[model samples]
Target: MTRDGPDNPARPLAGTDLCALADLADPGSKGFRFRQERLMFAGFVVRVGDEVRGYVDSCPHAGWPLAAWDDRYLTREGDLILCGGHAALFRPLDGVCVAGPCADQRLSPWPVAVIDGRVVTT
Candidate 1:
C-alpha cells in the first residue's frame, strides 16, 4: 500500500464517484490524484470495453509514477498498461507485470467499480 500519511487519500471511501463511464474512453485510462496538505495519492483506472480496473500509479520497481502524462497509461493498441517510467508492461485486468524490471510483481489494486454508468470507489 502507498500510504502517504494519516490521511489515507489513496483509498477513497466506498461509493465515491470518480467519473462517468461515458466520459472514460473504452480501452482507455484515466489518472487520479488525491491530496491532503503535503501528502498526495496517485492512482489510475483502466477501462477495457465494459470492464474497469484501478491500480495504484506507483511502479513496483522504483516506486515512481507509471505514466508520464495524464490519461496515458495504456499502450498504443490499448491492450496493456505501459509504465512510462521504465517501459514496463502490465495486464490491465490484473495489474500483473508481465515484462520489465518488476516481472512477476503486480501493481497494487485500488478497488473500483462501474455503477449505474459511473465509475466509483468500491
Candidate 2:
C-alpha cells in the first residue's frame, strides 16, 4: 500500500532512526521496510557524498517497487537512480524519471534527514 498517507500503518513516523550515515557508502543506496500488521512500507535512501535523498519504493509507471534486489537502486556507474523493474532511470537529487516507460514521471519523495550522523525520518 502507498505509505504517503498519515493513516497508512506502514508509514514511518518522524524522528524514526534508519541507519548511521557511516554505514552507508559514499555513493550508495539502501532500502528500508516498515510493517504494521498486514501493511508494509518500502522506501530507499541514496547517498551521494554528503547529500542523501529518499524516495518511495514504488515506480510510477508499473506501480511496483523499483529495486529488484536489496539496495540496488542506482545504475552500475552510480550516476542515476535505476528502476530495476522497467529499467527506468531517475535523477537522484530529485525523483524525476529521465528514461524508460516512466520518463518524465517522478518517484514520490520521502522526507528524511541526517541528524548526528544518523539517517532519520523527518
Candidate 3:
C-alpha cells in the first residue's frame, strides 16, 4: 500500500521481502537487492520514527550506489543521505537532492509496505 504523500508512490517490487522493520534502528538505513535471471533491482530503506522510506541506491549525479559500504547510507549525524560517489546529500525523508552535483534531482522511490511489522515490497 502506498502512503499518500509527495514522497511516496505506488511501486511494484516483484514480491521481495526487504527486512523486518524492527531490525532497522531508528534513523538507520539498510540496503537490499533482488535478482531474477539477469534482471536486478537494488535499493535501500531508511527508517525514521515508525516510518520507513525506500529509495533506489543509485546516486542521481553519477548513477552510482550511494553507499560505499554496506548500509552506510546516512551522513555522520544520521540525518541526511550521502552519496559515496560525489558527496551528494539528500533528504532522508524524500530522497530529494539537497546539496551537491545533483541538486534538485531525486533518488528514485521504491514503494514499500509494512506488513505485520515487516518491510516488504509493494
Candidate 4:
C-alpha cells in the first residue's frame, strides 16, 4: 500500500527521476502516466527554451487526456497547449484555458523540478 502525492512507488513519485530535460523537445510537450497499487498519476510536461511546466493530463472540460496522440500536446504552430478532445486551447506558460468550452478554467498543476538535467517530481 502507498499514499498519493509524491511518495508512491509509481514512476512519478517525489525524488523519482524522469527523463532528462534534453529528452523533451524545446517548445513541445510530452505525456506520462504511472500506476502503483491501483493508484494512477497522469500528467504532461511542456518545455519552452529553459522553462518547463507540468500539469495533470486531464482536460478541464471533458476529463480526458489532453492529447489525442501520444505525447502530442501542442498546437500545430507549437505556441499553446491543445486539448484534442474538444479543441480547447490553453496557454502553455500557465495552463489557463483561453478558448473553447472550458474557457477560464485551468489545468491542475503538478510539482516538478529539474536537477542535474533530469526532470523529477517535487
Which candidate tops TM-score? 2
Quote each prediction's TM-score: 0.92, 0.95, 0.85, 0.88
Instruction: Give the clash count for each candidate.
Output: 0, 0, 0, 1
Query: Model 2: what TM-score?
Result: 0.95
* Residue-wise C-alpha lDDT for candidate 2, range 8-106, written one tens digit per residue: 779899999999999888789999999987788888999999999989889999889989899989999898999888799999989999999988989
Estimate every model's Cα lDDT from 0 to 1.
Answer: 0.87, 0.90, 0.81, 0.84
Runs in model 4 lying further than 4 Å from the true structure: 1-11
Q: Give the 10-residue window scoring lowest on summed lDDT in candidate 3.
A: 1-10
In lDDT terms, which candidate is top?
2
lDDT (10s digit) by residue, model 3, range 1-122: 22323333232344568788889988899997655444556779998898899987788788778998999999989999999988899999888999999999999887887899999877
C-alpha RMSD values across all candidates: 2.3, 1.2, 5.9, 2.9
- Candidate 1 C-alpha lDDT tens digits along 1-122: 35733257555678889999998888999999886655677878999989999998889898989998888999999999999988999999999999999999999898899999999988
Candidate 2 local distance difference test against the native: 0.90
Question: How well does candidate 4 match the true structure in TM-score terms?
Answer: 0.88
> Pairs clashing in candidate 1?
none
Per-residue lDDT over 38-106 for candidate 4, one digit per residue giving the tens place of the 0 to 100 score = 777788899888889998888888788889999999998888999999999999989999999999999
